[model samples]
Target: MYDPAYGATDADLITFMGEEVREESAALGRRWFLVAELAGRRFPEMVGRQMYCADSISSVAAEISPVLNISHSRAVWQVETAITLRDRHPQVFKRLCRGLIDYRMVSMIVARTDNVADDVMVELDEAMAGRVEKWMKLSKNKLRDRIDLFIAEFDPAAVRVPPDADKHRYIDIDPGDTAGTAFVSGRLHAEDGAALDQRLDALADTVCSNDPRTKSQRRADACGPLARGEATLACQCGLDDCPARANRAAANAAVIHVLAEQGTIAGTSDKPGYLPGFGVLPAQSVRNLLPAAQTKPVTVPTADTAAQTGYRPNATLTEFLRWRDLTCRWPGCDKPVQRCDIDHTVPWPYGPTHPSNTKHYCRIHHITKTFNTGAGGFTDEQLPDGTIVLTAPTGHTYRSQAHGASMFPALRQPTGTVETTPLPPESPDRIAMMPRRRQTREQDRRERIATERRKRTEIITEQQRQHQAWLAATYEPPPF
Candidate 1:
């Protein structure tokens, strides 16, 4: 162990040892991606799979890899830095990189929807049925849920997904020639005037050319003529039958006229009536804001058809009920359609309405069902396998399962007790691998010297005092 001749100081020994360990750790990190891919499971699933592998040891980093994977595993260089000794200590660096790889893989599949192929969808009849075989096997529903969320966030408009063109983003109403054009004329305030003008410019540009920048980007760059001071407002598209132009214009005029007469600018318009000050309504919004008024049917009041019904005899009870359901049927939401509300798939207006459109929800999900802008506002459709498909406003769709994807199992009985799994223990090896305490060499030397001097001084002072006391006491005793 005495290696002075070799010039090996303790520092040298530690540095050499650290270098070796760091090299080995780096090498392991390099192979992590390949290891994750060969394992059919995603990066998150790898932690469980690796548990059974004899080569697998408990790693703090592996457990958190999914998060790190998305953040750090974007590029090779980033992965190296994330896992290298220069950044993280050798062992710790390796584990962190492992976690990153796992997360990266999971996020990719979820973001892309690697499952639910074109052929698979066609064979399954409806989109939701297709994902059943592919997605059901994953023990954790969180992964699938995350996949759906990712699709919702990143691809909500369903832009450029292959095989199904409808899955991609396209103009809702194609901008064609405006034959049956409608108009909304009124005084627009500063903010409203700016926004409307911007929209008009964007629409005009789109009409001129099919391609334009993104909506948000265009909005940001939009600087159009102000309409705050009274101005004529008219929108014309290339299409002769532009539903938005015709319907919205008609609705707006009716709404404005009514509001003007009443000397009030604000009111919800569900019917084809005019407000005094407000302009025409958008047709898409007409049913929710104002319902048409009609003469009540003559019917003898009966106990069954009580006042609670709010129905008049000879009244279109069917239409009235449809209107109620068409509103935010979710408890407590009164958001008009312009602000955005999910339409129930089943029509309540007609007899034996479709359940899909009847149960509408607004921006805030009611927490009863997964109501969202994704999957096209969460409509239910029967798949070929008789499974119900819940499509978000985004294009991604999933089947309602007997059991949920996470450890929080699906309800057995409505009254069953909910349980939560305990978190696992942390790895000691992982703890050991973190960067060591960073005391300075000078501070350490000073502390050691101070301690040594204090000990030596105490020894010397005790010896001197004892010698002096003994000399004085011995002479006195001899004399006596």
Candidate 2:
């Protein structure tokens, strides 16, 4: 192919290429919005014409693929997601349609807003308008952080409910057959998880002299023997004698220690309880774990008692706080509380050292709390329920919800086996075998519009015949 751009200067070529890429991304975003629009417009007309066997969205989508020369699945997905984004974040969607943001940015907006209530979504969408350029400069993770911050401030309801343990929990072991090893992973409730992580750390610290293995490598190597009940965590550093063996007593004391509300423990009412580092568990699970657990009761300070002690937390209070907060107080940061610095949200001695005023923050966020000031920096206010709503200098609010605060605990465990019923075989009429066609332009491929429409029409007519015959032979109207 002859190329006019081949003669251009390098700088011009780079500039032109970059501009085209951005515009093309914008064009595609607009095109998808149209796809959703087209489906809506053509659907009623198709219904009026009665060209479809059914009047549902699925039937409408089926016709769009053949008419436009696109895949039926792609058309449906684009329409559904586009419509959702439009409703949830109109401002961002408009910018995307105008080519101001790429599809990737659109996707990030969608992802971060997942599970957020619609009213909050609208608030977030309106909030993004003027600051999008600044957001563009951020890394994807940082952008996600910004979105999360917005959601927390605007819609704490989504963050308030921790992901259901039963739904999210799973265990997977990948066997590297030839490598003679397997990788195992799954979610554990916070309290159980902390114990496992602690044990791993203890074993990881047991290094022989001249250990060349990185901390991660040592941790990885330590898991096998710990699982197998072998205490020797020897490193491959070629040392004749290594002396960093951990105290078995501390490492072996890993156990679940849930802090159930005393009322729930006594069975008067089913108050949800917490497992530090894990999340809220039902009163039943709390009761289930308690009979086997070794209990050490620590008194949590009341505001009156806390204020009397010059606002300073005593050893008992500190221990209770560590147990209550298994990780950093920031919304999603999970730094273990044992290793975190206790920070007063309202910087002491101005703020009391009471449990209500104190929060656990990892070193990084601790500094962010101290130094982050002005409009862009973050500040927070704590609610009585332990929900902390943080506000950016920009005035957007975000929040960290208190975990283990379930209002209604599931006392009875869920019990059911997945039912696997076989679907009936597809009738010939329900199947469409597309005719082979020559390759076309990329845009045509995406749009599913091509010169093959006429030829494909013939294929559809023949399939309809087969479908009618099948209906004649097998259709059965359900008896009233």
Off by over 4 Å in 2: 1-252, 267-272, 282-284, 308-312, 323-327, 332-336, 374-376, 383-387, 399-401, 404-480
lDDT of 1 at 93: 28
lDDT for each residue of candidate 2 in 84-183, tens digit (9 for 90 to 100):
6666777887777666777767787776565566556777788876567568668888987777678667764343233347668776765434322456
Candidate 1 residue runs with Cα over 4 Å from true position: 1-105, 110-169, 172-315, 327-480
| Deviation (Å) of 308 in candidate 1 | 12
- Model 1 Cα displacement at 121 (Å)? 20
Best by TM-score: 2
List TM-scores for all candidates, in order: 0.19, 0.34
lDDT of 1 by residue, 346-432 (tens): 322321222211233433332223312222134454322112355443344554321110111211112111122432433434323
Worst 10 residues of 1 by lDDT: 404-413
The predictions' CA RMSDs to the true structure, in order, are: 31.8, 29.7
Candidate 1 lands at a TM-score of 0.19
